[model samples]
Target: MMYPPPESQSLKTLLPETPILLMGSGPVPVPQEVATASSIVISHLGETMKKIVARVQLMAQYVFQTKTTKIFGISGPSSAGMEMAIGSLLWPGRKVLVLNLGTFSARFAEMARGVGAEVKEILPQGLAPIYIEQVREAFEKDSFDVLTIVQGETSCGVKNIHLKEIVELAKSHGVLTIVDAVCTLSTMPLPMDEWGIDIVFVGGQKGLSAVPGISLIAISENTFQFISNRTQAMPHWCLDPRRAFKFWGLGEYHYTAPVTGILALHEGLRLICEEGLEARFERHLKCSSALQNSLEAMGFSLFTPAEFRLNSVVAINNLSNVNTKELISLLIKECHVEISGAFGLDIIRVGQMGEQSRFENIERVIRALAFGYGKFGHKLDLESGLKVLNISRDSGKK
Candidate 1:
């Protein structure tokens, strides 16, 4: 018996010769340092790995704006991080109040239901963000064991501006809060401890600009106590934080940890700390405002209004004359730039996440969008849009 020989291919033709620019909803380009970190893989149980893991936790706390040491990285995506929160906290007959705002909120409800929890969702139809009054009404109407919400809805670029207030109301009703900050953390201000958030999770691919596959999760002391006293065992062992903490917290073996992803996440969090949260927020805001204004000037409509729009990801409505799918093709195939089409929505999303929010990339994306629109036989105010972008860049220097 012998192993079969492998087929051979030219390395030159293995990938696209021209680098495709990632201006999409997530998995945006990582910085040089973060990319370099991902290549350094050491023994998962070694002392060097322990220090990296500790630094990651400390940096994650800084990014999450929390003092809780319960923060740790998950070997899966944000959904896995969220699954840990949902499965560990809820069991059969438990009730959850879902402030259904967008795609991810709907997913939270589905995941809660899967855990045998009673799910009640309050969805504000259309592109509007969930109002505080709606949340207040839900709390007053019935008692719930937990409340889950998204700080920023990635699907349509809508954000809950009243997140802190909503969390306070939930706490008043004795309901624990779990926030999905996958697209918001490090890109904007989400003071977890300050707002009394019980459980918070983030995806490294978006705001943190790390490659996909690793996500961060944190829990408050109160939430930890609740999980510790759960009636049933957690639904999953790999997704459970109690098992994960043995490796991330106590420096022990849990699984063959994704060392590369952890190192990349560590670098991402370090970059966020080095830039400082305030400056990072300002950068995202500056770039997003410019991108939004430029799009509007080019006669493109946005999915959500500026007041409650998510800055990290901006959704551009597919106008009556242009199909978003076709436009996305033009952006990718011809323009060498890429964006995302909303699932079952007449909108497309362009990312304003970490490296995507860089000034030069912002300009490049705007120019590529203009080119795509022109190719589709739709004349846009390209000069006007560029003028607005230039003005924003100049004003930002002050």
Candidate 2:
């Protein structure tokens, strides 16, 4: 039977045989250590699981660069992490100010509205990062119980470079801050504790380089106390921080945990620790900077401005001469590399997180893109692009 067999075939179709380079928004290639750990099945309530969780929590602290110990993993993608934060802090009659910069930030607004919170969103009118002035303008308009922002807006590669200041501004107004660190968490320096963010959530598949289904959240002590003191009961039982803390914080069982997923995440975090955050951040910067330089030399324009560009997932304008959908398909079919298209914008995203941050991997994807552009009758300066990548790599050795 053919792999991913036709819908007419049985449900137990074989997995695809060839490995395609995942250079899209997320679910990037997992490191060898993470892959090995995921293959082993263990009891969730066993002593072994406890040992792994213990180490993972410490390693996660280093990755987040946060002093908070109220960290735990939820059993889904990053969205699950988002839901947990919302359910724990937001309630009926509460007011939330959402900084709606792009697709991902807009989701926070929708989730806040779902929680029965009075949601007011500031939809910035450009592809640039939300300025401190914009945030200040919103603050002058009204007060909010909670302020939601995406540190790195993945949909457009826009990084809120003013996040630390914005959160400070909200804090001064007695507003709790929840940052969606999904695309930026491990790829860049977040410094959650220093930034005084109440809650920061991330997915395992992105910067963590683990498989999806296991997500993590970092909660400040103040945030935990706020959740505990709230009169309104948490709407979500499974995502409730009170119950989740009992399991991951207090070493008591709240529910059957995703053992395999935790193991994978633990290994992923271990890799981050082994590499050291400073080294990891530098590596990501070099690779991403090289990628941007090469793309520009190849005649592609970056959608996000250089000053506020996100290094994790890059957004580039679609070549006017090439059909983006067809180019993406050709890259997958002929070059075995996968990228992502925007929701409503004429741009394509290339992910540069975890294993994808390596120079060799970046080179591979650049070559694949050049090949695709060539097939579409637009011959990019491939040699110049490669030279730029080489120069960046060489400069990093200094």
Candidate 3:
């Protein structure tokens, strides 16, 4: 039988509209001026807008250090970035080795196989991550043309330590390393060229705090030459990076890059530079730590192990006598705070990304959540948790 919505409308009515806190998906608050700048770029670059494309590619280098790259504005959401990367690189007869620790990794494995590449998955169940030892063993067992891994597993709130080492491993084996930093880039430290990452893809919607439409793919000089040497046909028209590179190099749109999204992404990257990546990383780490400390004191167990936990995000277990789905709805409908459901079951994640990583916002989320949980019939030790949240928030302010 389908479960009924918990908590009466009576409870929801007493709460505020549009939850005062947002701890869900990235796309954190954008500065008024930055938001306006993106809109202005879109309107001003009407019709002949290759300049927008050039600006995006150049700005990406400034922010991400993804030198000599191609930007594609294919028809798909953030997830499409992976498909574009995989479909473009993997040939029909190629073999792919994927080190998957979460849902996105699984999707990558599936997509690679669908493209007719032989795929193998190395995933760790429960709350742990795939360590470097496991990856080394996998590499020894099988040879692969390309090695792919997600930088941050958004599904489980874990960051695999194997990202840098694994990429280096691929380099040693004469295999290409493709990193899915769709959720990690800008939020954390990912130096593409320095780290020898051949192909790196990230979405604008996450830590960049821009609307979802654009995906940034970086191609290294070595990988560019490697792909060009391949005899396989480009699987898709819009995703072909060779075509994109020519257009970007000549400052023209081979296939129109997302004009408006390019604008939004430019502003977003601008803001990141303004804030400084090192400072931003510290803020995200601080915010996630504060949230985790507060939740743990309130008796919420973390689904991911403490050491390997992602600094930009955290996943918490469902409290006793609480339905995760119903609790999430109440958080939105009543408290006006939004969080995401767990990767597997009864879990809720708190995201600290971009402007949402601010101390004030984190405090509001902790306070409102403390109050909100009471309405759900869970006796969350409100005073203790809020006290911890405030302490960390104040510490961060200083």
Task: Indicate which candidate wins on TM-score.
Answer: 1
Q: After superposition, which runs of candidate 2 have C-alpha atoms over 4 Å from their true positions? A: 1-13
- Say which prediction, candidate 1 or candidate 3, comes out ahead on TM-score: 1
Please give the CA lDDT of all the candidate structures: 0.89, 0.89, 0.75
- Model 1 segments more than 4 A misplaced: 1-6, 10-12
Q: Write the per-residue lDDT of candidate 1 for residues 284-373, one digit (tens) a residue.
A: 999999999999998889889888889999988876677888888878888789899997888889999999998788888888887887
Steric overlap count per candidate: 0, 0, 1
Query: How does candidate 1 score on lDDT?
Result: 0.89
| Residue range 1-398, candidate 2, lDDT tens digits | 76785557553464445678999998999988899999998888757777888898999988888888899999888999999998888888899999998889998888888889999988776777778898899889888899999989989898998999999999999999999999777888899988888999999999899988999999998889889898897889899988998889777898998888999999999888898888888888889999999999988899988889999999999887777899999998898899998888899999999999988888989999999989988889989999999998888465
For 60-123, candidate 3 gives per-residue lDDT tens digits of: 7755666765554444566677887798779788989888877888888988988899998887
TM-score of each: 0.96, 0.95, 0.89
Superposition TM-score, candidate 2 onto the true structure: 0.95
**How many angstroms is residue 89 displaced in model 1 relative to the true structure, after the best TM-score fit?**
0.6
Clashing pairs in 3: 19-336
Candidate 1 TM-score versus the reference: 0.96
